[model samples]
Target: MFFIYRLFLIILLLFTAVTTVFSQGTTKEEKRTLKKARKFLANEKYQLAQANYLKLLTLNSKDVVYNFEGGLSYYFADFEQAKSVPLFESALENSKEDTIPELCYYLARAYHINGDFEKSKEAFTHFKPFIKTSTKSGQELMKQSDYYININDNGKKQLANKNENTIIKNLGTSINSTYGEYAPVMKKNEQVLLFTSRRENGTSKKVDTDLLPYEDIYVAKQVNDNWQLITDKVELEKYIPKDLNTKKHDAGVIYSSDGNTLYTYKNDLIWKSILENGKWSNLVELDKNINSSQYNIPSVNLSKDGNTIYFTTTRKDGFGGKDIYKSSKNEEGKWNVAENLGDKINTKFDEDAPFISDDGKTIYFSSKGHDGIGGYDIYKSELTDNGWGKAENMGIPINSALDDIYLIVDEKEKNGFFASNRDGGIGGIDIYSLCINCPTKIINTINGLLVDNIETPIDGTLTTQLLSSNNPAETTQSKAGKFSFVTATTGKHQITVEAQ
Candidate 1:
């Protein structure tokens, strides 16, 4: 009996020692989890980190760090409504005096994100001085608060003004509101409009989640002046690799005249897609001759023949911001080296949204670099034998103080269309039309070296007739024996040269 009692005592002592060690290990794990949660929050992974922090809170209910981190996580996750009144309130209620200012700052941010402007202002007012004199983050928070206050005041006025008829309509319940819709490209027919949107129920929605709304290219046909959806929405996310599928932002697209070729801008690279058998093929990145790792291609325009490409980039040695550049296709069907349009066309400010005329003789673009009414204005320059001539403003009725972009012209119809966010539109931005009013007056001049068919120099009299249809408007003879005519309206005119 003595031996058995001694053995039992030894077993009891060993069990007690093991329990103590396990309890100590549990304490160490809680500490480690708390530290890791804080690190994740700092890196902006609020959701994952917040879950861990909340678990820690259950184990240690009075922990101030858990309350603070949980509130921040909710705020970053955009669940500001849930966080603002509860998580923030709890943190402020329990925070020590030394942490009051930080707690108040976070509470204000939560309120701000929740759209509770008045409450946010009150909290910021109390927290500003402490942040200014204390931490670096505090200083930044104060600056940010001041910026938000100003933005709020200005944004209200801007929003109110934007409701006027002069503003573009919000595309209403049909084309927008359900999703993020932007980057519209309209054909000259105006019957078909192509745009990009992040809408639901798209193919590859899972993969597209990395880009949110899964920004896809959508086409809508105009029926009775209203846009009607057609074709299955296409998401470019599948073309992207898993490692490059960013949850951030991507998308800007332009198509060739025939719509057989497509150029897309995503993740700082330019990709090309070919239309085959009525379907778009897999996208391939453009050759290095046109694309660079230094900067991204934001916009692009292709000439009528598809042999010339104009694009915008912020590569080094550029004028400023993003500059317009041109590259031509060689005989091998590869892009030649890119060439800047030079200082005449580019300025120390941003110049983008380039469109070459169908005739390929005139180029239209928007620029903040040139002296403008305000923001960006549309400008055009004709291609001369010596290169591009001086740019000319399209003038007041066409240009505005607000952003004007995506200029298009139909040479055959002599009509132009451009997008603007100016004082008149459906909302955001609206397309406008401008007519080319051809002049009526005609001028004729005849000047050329007088040479016979046999290449012999001879004195000659050149007679030119300015004709429209069957009737001749004017008949003129060249005094210097050379021929040239300038007609107000474009038409077939007859000319006759006789040597004397």
Candidate 2:
């Protein structure tokens, strides 16, 4: 009887310990932190919420609510989406699906950004049945889920056969930071680069509705084949120009062919600044026809002759969210009403960051509605006799399972630049340069199976000698009847096997 009582006490102690580890006490400081975190999350301040939840998670890693909310915080923060997958997984493991019905959708999004399309599809499938189509929000959720599933399928196909011939490389730390850097536009000579960033060094440390720092324009100049940030006060003032960057949001749209006129987006309106006498003039808002009071214009590009302007907007009359529109100047040089690019190039989702080629026959933009892999993918549509051709996705290595926007190619098309939030970047979104039609130097590998005439496994030494003159030969001993060699040159190589 005494042993039984002692055993009960042991069990009770174990239960208490487990509970203590998995849950936080009502301490005033912890309670305050939890309250602040929840408030920030509800208010869509994801970055701040993420910081607070990180503290709570450290204190109680096994709490279901903490894990789920923490997952959402990271998920919506947009930069480190991969960090959400494990937290969502933990939440789902500790709770019932019905109790956390929204978990699957977010988990799928996290998976999609991480390039795990198969898992993402499964999570989306699990989420579909929970959405009730009767309600408007529910119907929207259903549609969003279906959209993700379709794009996930596309992601799987495109990522499996990524473009190997194209070389895409990050622009390095000088041109990027740990914050979001996007919407890159370059001068015709490719000597100067102007991009938008939310880095901490902006004019004012103020945050926008999403709790991210307000956008600011930054400039970098090429030095010895590498980009260097223009940091000298005199150089920065010269390149940035007064009033070009403000405490409020400011972003780069495109640079004119002459590099004298700069089109920009400020507070959802299209504006332009002219470079005269080595200084940029104050921004002038575009014509009323181009700057609609009812919608936001995120991007714009000009015809070579500066007669027509292509811009992106989300007016209610648009095909859906944002769509590309063009406005041509009248005989009096006044802007005319805009015309939508039509169903061929626009969709029910967003289309933004249009860049018209110098020829004005082809335009490149970013879209989320088309047959995309994930997030927003860059696409190009060429104008034909029939109208704009169906936009073609710019395919992998140029576009990843993350937002890739604002692509601009040199007149020769030999090199191009864009921005993406794909993994392995130094920030949420970093500028990247692509070598167009450049030769790819790939190392080829040779593998051989060593076996006796009876087909039994045999130990052997494999030797590989390059056909090129004066190159050293390499040898590898077989391991379990297998041997391999890597060739550095494209030239033919000879392989000889010796049985042991």
In model 2, which regions exceed 4 Å deviation? 1-63, 94-99, 236-240, 443-500
**Error at 363, model 2, angstroms:** 0.9
Cand. 1 Cα-lDDT: 0.59
Cα lDDT tens digits, model 2, 1-500, are: 00000000111211111222334435788888888998998786777998899898878787787898899887766456677888999987887434445667778888998889999999999878776666676666777789889999998888887877777767756777878787787766658888888889688788875556888888888876657787676786556567777898888757678777878888789888888999888888888999977887877888878889999888777889889999999999889999999998899988888888888888999888788997689899888999999988878878887888878887766578988878656657888888766686775878878899988767666767767754555555564576666555667787877785
Note each model's CA RMSD in angstroms.
Answer: 26.7, 13.4
Runs of candidate 1 with Cα error greater than 4 angstroms are 1-182, 187-190, 197-215, 231-250, 413-417, 424-427, 430-500
Best by lDDT: 2
Please count the clashing residue pairs in each candidate, in the order shown: 18, 0
**Model 1, range 124-183, lDDT digits (tens) per residue?**
777666543355554555576675555334323343433121211223334543334555
- The alpha-carbon deviation from the true structure for residue 130 of candidate 1, after best TM-score superposition, in angstroms, is 28
TM accuracy, model 2? 0.76
Evaluate model 1: give its TM-score: 0.48
